[model samples]
Structures are given as C-alpha cells and as structure tokens.
Target: MAISGVSIFVVGIALLVSVPLSQQNEEVHLKFSYSGETGPDKWGSLKPEFSTCSTGKLQSPVNIVTKDVIYNPKLQPLNRDYRTSNSTLINHGYSIGLFYGSDKVGVMIHDGKNYTLKQVHWHSPSEHTINGIRYPLELHQVHIADDGSISVVGVLYNYGAPDLLLLQIKSKLDELAKEACGEDEIAKIPIGHMGTKYLRRGAFKYYRYVGSLTTPPCTQNVTWTIIAKVREVSKEQIEALTAPLEGSCKSNSRPVQALYGRKIELYNAMPNKI
Candidate 1:
C-alpha cells in the first residue's frame, strides 16, 4: 500500500507538470507593453526561455530613408481572392493586430504548385524598414506554400486619399475584434479589387529580409517583403486605430532596433510603363 501511494503521487505530479507545458508549446493570448513584466523591457525576461527576444540581433522595426535607386517594376505580386474569417484582437504587445484569414501564399499549378493565403495582420507606424526607412502603417499578408515555407508580402501605408477598402473595413473593426473569427463568417468582410490592387501596385521599393514577427513566439525563418510606397489614411483613421481599449491606452508598434549588420538589397531596375 505504501509503495502504491508513492507511485500514485508521482503520477499526479507528472500530469500536473505536463499539462502546462503542453499549453505553452502552443500559442497563447498575450498583451502588449513597453515597460515592465508585460512591457517591452520584459519581453526577453518573462521567462528564462524567451531570451531570443532580448539577444537575437536581427530584430525588426527598423528605420527607412529612401535611397536614390530604381526597382524591377515588372515583378508584380500575384492576385487571388484572400479569404478571411472572424478575427481575434491582439492589443497587449507590439501594435494592435486583428488576426484572421486562412490560406497561404505560393504558386498554384493545376498540375504544378499552389500557394494558399494563411493569415493577415497589421502594425501601426509600420514594422518594416525599406532601404532603412520606416512608414506609418504596414500590413502583412502572410501566406504558406504547399510545402510549409512562409512568404510575407508587406503593404506600407501613408497619408493620402482615403483607401476605399479601409473605408469599408474600418467601420466593422471594433466589432470584428471582439473575438477570434471562425471560418464560416470570414466572408463577412470582403477584400475587393481596390484592396487587391493596392497590394499589387503599392510600391516596389521593398526590402527582402530574413526576420521574425516583431511580437512574441518571435518565430524566425520568415521571408519578409516590405513595399516602399505608402497609401494614405485620414488622421481620423489613425486616431481610431490608436485609441485605447476598454482598459488600456498604448501605441502598438514595436520599438525600432539597430540594423545589427544585416545587408539590405534593392531590386535596382525601372518600373514598367502601364
């Protein structure tokens, strides 16, 4: 009886430990910050485990100052219907991100290869650096290939004429953010031609870099393509985006970091005449 009791106690402790570890192995909802335990300062310190947050030198969110160079205007992004579902709002870390959509980006060959669009999200004041300069807002359209490799096309935003797509989605943002969206309701917010064209024609002054999400899980091995031309959003749009939640008031961009010896390449060519 004594031996059996000891064995049962050990098994109970083992189950307790494994449960939390399994959960941590997967993504969890996290809040954003710039200061303490929940702040940017603690991103790398929350656990002895998250050291990559502090020590990885190739961090993102860099500055961009356009260089006098041309790019391959011929390389236009492919167009396809990006399906989105319900989305979840992430406001605790980085900037505000409303994650939804399911598909990955890649080439689809009827008998060859196809890429599916996976998830889409955004960063305020932008998170990508073009030739070393940053912009106002950057939207990341992340896709996955059939083989599981990841490719991200980043769209930069600036102040200009109001984007019709923004006009369409802006009104529903507060509501869409109420919870993580499911597949059935994804079509409620349609990504139309204007949105598609914006992704294709925005700017070719992009930088192809190897980096991680500016947020936690800090997943590396991501291919980043950041567009240079920015589309405009009204001040009202910016204000609406940056407004505090029911319990907090904070800007959602990740702090810019040093280049740390990364090489930035530009496709020095000319834009094709349309």
Candidate 2:
C-alpha cells in the first residue's frame, strides 16, 4: 500500500460520499470536458467567460512537492465543526454530488474566517499529487463564506476498508445515477442525514494554499486545505461513486497546472509527529 499523501474518497452501492464545485455550475460545464476539443487545454477558448482558464495567474490542482514546502508555525490547525445532517445525493450530468439541504451541516475555521460546509464531491485518480504520486480517489468538501468566497477541504484516498457512510447510500446513489443522467438538479434524492465522522476523525498533517476551483471559470483565490490522513475506501465503493456521471466526469480530473511560484504551507495537527 502507498503511504505519504492520501485521504478518503468514499462511494458505494453499499456507504457514504459523491462529486465537485465545478458540477454546481452546470451551465459552464455544459460546454467543457476532460478531453478532446473542450478539454483543459482549450477551456478558455470555449467561451468568453472561461478566459480565466487560460489567463489566470493563480490556478489550482498544483502538485504539492514536499521538499519545497515551507512549514508555517503561524498557521493554525483547521477548526472544523461538523455533524450528521439531513443530506441528499444528486447527479449533476457531468458529476455526482452529496449536498446538505435546509439544515446546517456545520463549518470550518481557518485564519479566523468561518465557512459553512456545503457539499462533498469526489474526483477520481486524485487531483493534487504529492511528490508526483496521485492516489485512486479524492474528496473535496466545499464550504462557502458569507461573502461567497469558497474554501475546500480535500481528502486524498488509497484502498482500504469500506466506508460506512458510503455503504448507507449505495442504493440511492445507484438509483440516481441510473435515472439522473444529463439532468441538473440539487439534492432531489434524499438519503437522510449523514455523519461527519470522516471529517473529524484522527489527527493528520494538512497542506494549505491559495488556489482556484479545479473546474471551470477556473476561479482563483479559493482556499484549499488537503488533509494528509489517507482514508480507507474499497474498489467496490469507487465504482458506486462514478456510475452516475457521463463524459469528462467519467474520469474527471484536470491535468496539474504550473505552480507559478506559489508557496505551499504545511500544517500538522500533531506537531512533529508526521
């Protein structure tokens, strides 16, 4: 089994979790994909608004080089306040997403700013690599601040035991994927309340940086926190997550972009232990 950088990307016909922030803007994605003419390289030319895809100085999904990382003693551990809340898993045509509705799922505090946890989405083959290693799956917990700035908590995963949360939602996920292809809807498939155990469990090293959404508009200034604790997920679980989406989403993950001299900061919840 590979170690180093990994986090939980949960899925199932059996437990918990599903899809990305980019899926939220179905309009923009309707014109883009992971390959071919509308691929990452041509995202900017697809539309006038997508110019940032080619022009932005600060982009996301950069490979995190450990040796080049600077430890920031001043950086604080991510303060997460989460819980089991009423949730729904939906298909976004190009992606599948697990979203919280009506109820407050919770929030996380970084640099004294509080962002509400909105939804959790998965990206296969992991987006942000560590030491040039890309894991099997990645989960991005999207949070939005009052001013609408986005902060994402990323979980990279390697194979292990099945996640219970995914096991609980497997049937609903399958049902939606089978019926919801090419539809843009929010939380229509209620899977009841889900736990926040994965987010709160254990102590791990996390990397912090300023970047953009991995998806289009390719919006910058998004804060990214990638937890270094790799979580367990089974192969069966992986298939359950991807069964719904079509096209670029089938193997959705943008190619790693250049760092452009951006500084990557490392934070350890248990100092000096990792």
Candidate 3:
C-alpha cells in the first residue's frame, strides 16, 4: 500500500553523481542542492508545484519543550524485523558509504490496516527543527502500512557525552566498505545487542507531519517524530561520519525550512508506560 499519493522511489540510474545512496537512484543517493540552482531553496523556484515548500504550512522539526498532552493513545506492537544482520552499505557521500545497523526493532504497531514498519535512515546535523533550533543528527525510522498511512520514530543526537553503541559503529565505520554485504550479510549485524532503552528514556517529545525528504526528488508522505533528547559524539566522531572521500561534498545536511501553517503536536507530555 502506498502512503502518500506520490509514488515511492525506486532503484534507478545513479543520480548520485557521487555516493551509492540506496540500490535505486531516487532512494537516498541523489545529490541535493541546499541553496541556489539545484539546491533546497531553489526546489520550489525550479517548479511551480514545489510552491508548497515556500508557501504551505505545517512544516516539520518542532522543538521539544514540555507541554500538556492529554490523550495517551494505546500503541500496539506488530511484527518486528530489527536485526544487526539487517545492516547494509549505501553510498551517501563521496567517501561515506557508511553502514546502517537496522534489525527490525519489532513492529511497535502494525496490522494489515494502517501503519507498518517500512525502513529507517539517518540525516547528519538533523533535517528537522525544534523550537527553531536544529540538532546534530536525526534518525528517521519510517513506517508505512496497508492503506497509505505513515509514522516515523525520530531519535535525536546532541553534543557532549557520547553513546557507546554509536561510538562502536563509528569505530567500525572505516570498515564500512568491507562490512558491505547483501541482505544475508546485513542479517548478521547485531541490533538487539545494542541498548535502545536510553533512546526512550526521559522527557521524550515528538513532532509529526506530512513532509517530504529534505533531499532531492523530495517526495512527501512522511510522519515525523523528532526526539527531544540528543546523543553525543566527539568532533572526531563527527569527522568520521562527514569526511568526504576524494571528490565529494563536505556536508550532507539540508537547511531548515521556515514553518508555514502546520500544527505541531507536543506528543507525550504525560509519561508513557513502557
């Protein structure tokens, strides 16, 4: 089932001009111009249809301060496919075809009905905004189910203290190219071994919306969830993730969009029982 009316991307010819993105061209490998010409700012300028970006309201990446949230919706877990073995290597930048460690963390909610776990990806220096502030990085866990509904789980990272799991992955990043394996190889990565409890702890807030990829061919239909807390990484760690190999762009983050008319949800004001 399709989530947004817009067709999901497919593996096509390399529009990357650089990294290997996903198996497909439009997947996550396309180059994004963040400013003028082919950049993010120029997207709407490029096409009349893209006017929404500059005009439409309800943009994503709201800040996470405490708010009074009333109703606590009961969330159900569906089928989980999280596994370290699920990791795969895709070209993101010139030298950064890093590895992604996704081992179906378990379908938190899925039925042949609404939202189901699709896949997840990451964005350096975050692609979302929180109270007009931006974080260092954001992890987007995209979920789409039966009839075209979308829900995303967002994990935010901050400066300061570093996370072991992340550091571990960072340590092995140099080996990412060697870590590249087909689906079977990905199936061997250990996701469950890494602790995720820290991710859900504390005053975790979220922001939801119907937005598109911050990058090129920016297709919409994404329900975002930006976590309030931030994870830490050293300057060296950040370098590991951003160091473009040979010929490539230095940064991979998209600039923040001005909020238009989207209503922000201060989800989880009340403590959720895990």
Candidate 4:
C-alpha cells in the first residue's frame, strides 16, 4: 500500500503505507516507479511473483465510499499491545522504515488472533482516499499472525500542527535523505527503545476490509484497518518523511484501485471503550 497516485493530494481528511522489515518485502530494490514503464501498471508483469498485483480481485488503496460503508457492530476496537523495542531506522531508497529487532515488539488482538507488530512506514500524498479526498500523509502499522496472515492498522494525517512522532526523528530523517541521494551506503540508524504508541493517532472508529499488500508481489488476504479520524501533521513533518526518497521524486503513493466487489465495513467503537 505504498503511495503511487496521479493527483496532488487533497486532504478533505482521510490513508496507508507499509515498508516491511526486510528490504525484499518493500521491494526497494525492485525496478518499480510511480509512473512510466516500471510503474504500478507494470508491477504484475515485472516478475512472476508479482502477478497478483494485476490479477488480484481485491487490490488495496481503495477509495472509501463512506456512505456505502456498512457499520458492523461486531467489529471490535483496535487492540494493539505494542511496546518499546530496540529498533533500527533504515532509509530504503523508496521509503523510510522503522524496523523492530526483537523477536516481537507487540501484538494486536483481533478476532482472537495475535498479530505481532513488525514495522512501521510512511507514504506521502496518502494512498487510500475518503469520500474521494486524499490526505497529506499516511502511517502504516504492519503486523503478522502465526499463520502468516497480515493485519495493517493505518493512520492518516493532514497538514496541521506537527506530529510528535515525526518531531522525534526529524533530524535523523534529514541525515538519511542525504545518504539515500549519495547511493554509496544505505542509512541505518540504530535508535534504541523506540515505541510504536506514537503511531496510535486518530479516533477509535476504523474502517476494515480485506485487501492486498500495496506494493509488489501484491499478496492478497491481508486485513486492513484504517482509523476513521484524521491526525494533524505539519508540512515540515511531511517533508522530513519524504526527504529520504527525494531521489525518486516526492510522489510515492499508489493510485486507488478498483473495489472489485469487496465490502468495506466501519467499526464504530462504543463510548469510552476504545
């Protein structure tokens, strides 16, 4: 669900991006761009493993038609038991990723399954849209279950007051941006005891759906949970997040994909429950 759209984002307020712990998963080394021959349109054919990118019935980064969203009472609040972990910040040429080094950082309990937290990443101009509007930034909290199933909790951000999460790592991002442009070495910052709570922005309400991985090898059956409330982020914060990827141009968002009969459900949390 990494960014790749055509329009300059318009935040009427509503998101996603995920850079995996391994560079291979983010496909950073892959020859895919937001446009041109190796762009999103050509992802499925770039390699045999990426065939799902073109053929998957339920591709991600779908526009959430709020009116059509079925309010599922059974849907539960997002339960993430994240902790402080020894983490590494890697500036993959295409994205900035925060990776957990421990056996597990934490887990989110959904449908009684514990999806272990893996990594978090950002995408500019947002990937998912709300009511046909796109936000300035999106943060993805990616997790996986014992059976290899995936669950991503997304938080969308708009231009406003600075995000504390970005504030903490701004300087590091600036340094990484220079390293990414240099091409001699990948910037790997060993930031100790980083916690994932910084990613928990927005309201308790969220929209849930079954979708594919936003990036290539576009795996299917991944669960997506997008926070309903939009968080505040300043333009400077957005700039810091995208700086490391300036070599590839500022736009990294993937355009919204066809819904293909997939159902989007909203989890309206009970008062004081979330």
Candidate 5:
C-alpha cells in the first residue's frame, strides 16, 4: 500500500509540535566532526557513549564490489510509502539533515518488516563506494522500526542535471550553510516525492548488509540497502551540500570500513521472485 502526499504533510506538522524545542536544542552541542581531534578515528575516545566507533566490528560505509556480491532472488522490492511534508533544515555540525516533523511517518516495507522514515541527510565524497569508486555525493534516508532498529537507504549522486528536490531546498541549504551551525525555519518540502523518485524508478538492484551507524554510538544491527544505480545532481547542488562542512572538516565521510567477512546480498529483479 502507498501513502498520499497530503497525509504526509499533515503528519509532519503533528510531529513538529510534539517535540519541544528545548529538548532538541540541548542535543545540538555534542561536538563531533569529520577531522582533527573530533574526527571519526577519535569518536570513540571523545565520549564514553561513542566507543563503538572504534570497537564495533560491523561498521558501515564499506566498499561494495560487484563481483563479491551474492545474488539473492528472494529479496523483496521495497514498498515505500512517502509524500511531501514540512521539514526543517539543520546543520548538525557533522552533516546537514532535513528532519521531518515529529508526528509525520513514512514507511518502507521489506521482508515483512516496516521501517518508518525519520530524516534525510547527505555526505560528500560518498562514504560507500562501488568497486572502490566514490561518487561526488551520497544521500541517506534514515528509517526506524517500531522496536527502534534503524535502516538506511543510500543513493549515490553523480554530476549531471540538477535534481528537482535538491533544487527546491537549495535556497534553504545556502542560508543554513552561511551559519556555522544551527537550523533554519521550518519549510514545506517534497521529501517523500524526492525519495520516491529514486527508489521507484531505479534499477531495483541493490546491495544489502548488516552494519552499524556511520556516526557516533555507531550502534550495530542496522540494515543497509544501497541502490546500485547512480542518480544525478548538478555540480552546484554538490557545492551547496558540501560547502557548509568545508570549514570544520576536510570531508564528511568515514573511510570505507573492513567487510569483516560479512556477506553482501545483491537483490536482483527476477520474474516470479519474491
């Protein structure tokens, strides 16, 4: 089943009011970064809660080699329910994120489980690579299950014509980029539409693996589905995404982690397959 765009907008508004501003403000000072003392390598040491960054064996952003992937006909096509919604643009210090309102909910169905969309964020010089080749940008749509498990659907962007969704938020991004850190006023954005465009039209082929969050806490048991087909975004869009992060960190991506013998399943579209 699919969700309507108007329903998504209403839910987003509900979520925004449910969360108090004070609580969100308090979380803005965690002090993590992409380089120097607070870099990825130092994440575990900076805070006790972030120890997983250095110690976790199942870390994410691994290099995906096509030759090493096992074809899985059983993997189901993603059932995405999304729509345009009001969103807030935040400069999280480490990366830029577009967050949905607290009451809003979008879901992705896979293997009989449902993961609700929470927010969308970007990383430059793409963290996950295809056969060791990194793209100009990467987009991550973060989702959560009722049990709080996380699943991130990743899309890599190559240089090309501008993306309509990116263009819609370009002005807000530029404004946020000017400030070192903080959030802009809430704006209505077609987030669900943006996500749908990528997930629905692309080659259904994707690489799946279990890994930890790319950020601190580095919590494990996260599911990742990275679309094999690349998407297009303009050079200007790439600049808008990365410019804000340039002053503090050389790059916003974690170096590709070791596969650690983890098996990667390539979900291929086959007739009469699940």
Candidate 6:
C-alpha cells in the first residue's frame, strides 16, 4: 500500500539532528511516568529523541469531534485475519501488554497493504476521546507493515457487561498486577480465539487518520483507525485491569494532542448521511 510519508526511522534520525554530540552519546536514563517530574509534559526535555512528543504536528490521541469528520466512501472496511497464537503478558512499568510470537502472523489489510499484528496493549481511562467523552478503557492492537510502517486499531470500552474477549485474559491481568510489576511475565493465555471473535463483530465502523504513537519516541508514521463503536466491559473487569497497576502506573494515558488541521475520515459499512 502507498503510505504517505517518510519511513519512521528516517523521521527519528531527522529529529535527532537537533541534539548535541555529547548529549546524544550520553547514556540518558530517563524514566517517563503518567505524572510528576517525568510526566508527558517533560517528555521532550527528558530525552533528545523524544522531542517530537512536544513538537510534532501529527501527534495522536486527539479528541475526535464527529462534527469535524468527513464521511469517506472510498475508505475501505478493515479486513482482518487473525489466528489464535501463543501470547505473553508483560508489565512494562507503564502499561500491561499482551504479545504475540513473531512467527505466528495475523494481518490487517488497510489502504491496500497488509500490516501484521505485533502486540496488544491497554490504556486505562483511554487516550482517544470521542466528542470530548473518554471511555473507561481503550484497547490498542498494534500492527506493522513489512516496510516498518505502523497502523493501530483502537477499540474503546465503556462500563456495562463484561467483554468475553477481555474475560479470557482477566485472570492473567490480576496475576500480572499483583506479581508482575516491572517484569515481562508471560501469562499462559491463549488469545487467538478471543481476538478473532472480537475483531469480527459486525456493526462496527472506524475513523481513520495519520497520527503518532501515544508514547515517547512518539513516532508519527502511524495510520490510526479508531473504531467508532464502543464496546462494553463491566466495572469489575475495569478494576481487574487497573488495580494491579494502581500504585506505580495508576493512569498510563497521554493527554489529547492538537489536531493541526489533519483530516479524519469516518468509514461506514452502510451508506448514510453524515
């Protein structure tokens, strides 16, 4: 598929030019947190490489206003082919993540290119908001194209009945929260079935844009598709996911960044007036 910009690696290098040789070579151990001295506000100053976090025009997790979206008939429906695979859960000091094996590939076709599923991660209280409304939880399925381009499919969750797919990993989440802080503990969770079922559900639509990663080294090569449909997850499930990371990582979401006049496209399966 024809992605619209320079490779992310190139962008990183371009941004790094502003750093001095001494600071560039110095082993800077900057710890980024949800709040405090090392919070998002200080990310750009923390590390020379993360300058984009403070200055990039295409930063992500914007407050998506429906009134600003353009209904695009040309935007194709997401074509996902995910298989059940052996997955591992990790507590990365900031957020919890479920990783898939490199060999076990699942692909999502967007803009005519296949981006392979890499890992899934969560942000409590969500990062992206719809009409200034933040959901209780947000699930990000991170994918990468063969050429190193990134595409993330974001699903938002509200409080209601528990999601079956989330339930499949609930126990693992609890264990990781209590025992796996700052460790890459692999939970023996089979995620293929749950992931497939969740992605294949009908009546879902998405808003597409080109934005940056929510975290530091906030690369701006992402093709973001935020699912317009909000799913349900019980309050208990929300607690199960957040309780463990309470003290050290209470909230790992970034604040909404400026949109900078970037156009967001809403893709609907059925034709409807905007």
Q: What TM-score does each of the candidates earn?
A: 0.65, 0.85, 0.62, 0.85, 0.82, 0.83
Error of 1 at 197 (Å): 4.7
- For candidate 6, the per-residue lDDT at 27 reads 24
> Lowest-scoring 10 consecutive residues by lDDT in candidate 4?
8-17
Off by over 4 Å in 2: 1-29, 183-187
Residue-wise C-alpha lDDT for candidate 4, range 71-95, written one tens digit per residue: 8888887777777788777755556
Tell me the RMSD of model 1 versus the true structure.
10.7
User: In model 5, what lDDT does residue 256 have?
Assistant: 89
lDDT of each: 0.48, 0.72, 0.45, 0.73, 0.70, 0.72
- Ranking by TM-score, best first? 4, 2, 6, 5, 1, 3
lDDT of 6 by residue, 185-271 (tens): 222333443455675465347899999888777879688999988999898887777665535457878999999989998898875
Task: Indicate the residue-level lDDT of 163 in model 5.
Answer: 74
Which stretches of candidate 4 lie above 4 Å from their native place?
1-29, 180-185, 201-203, 270-274
- Candidate 1 matches the true fold with a TM-score of 0.65
Q: Which ranges in model 6 have alpha carbons more than 4 Å from their true place? A: 1-30, 180-195, 246-248
Best-fitting candidate, scored by lDDT:
4
Instruction: List model 3 lDDT by residue over 125-222, tens digit each.
Output: 67665555677766666555444455567776777676554565664454543443321122112232443343334444444445554544444555
Q: Let me know the TM-score candidate 3 reaches against the reference structure.
A: 0.62
Worst 10 residues of 5 by lDDT: 7-16
Tens-place lDDT per residue, model 5, 41-136, is 898897787788888889988999888898887898988877655666655445667777665446888879987777777888899999999999
Per-residue CA lDDT of model 2 for 1-274, tens digit only, reads 1111211111221011112433443222235667788788998897786688899978889899888888888888777899899887765544567778757788888888888888887888788999999888888888887667788888888899987767878888767755634333322487787778776665458888898887766878888888877787888888888776665568878888888889999887666664
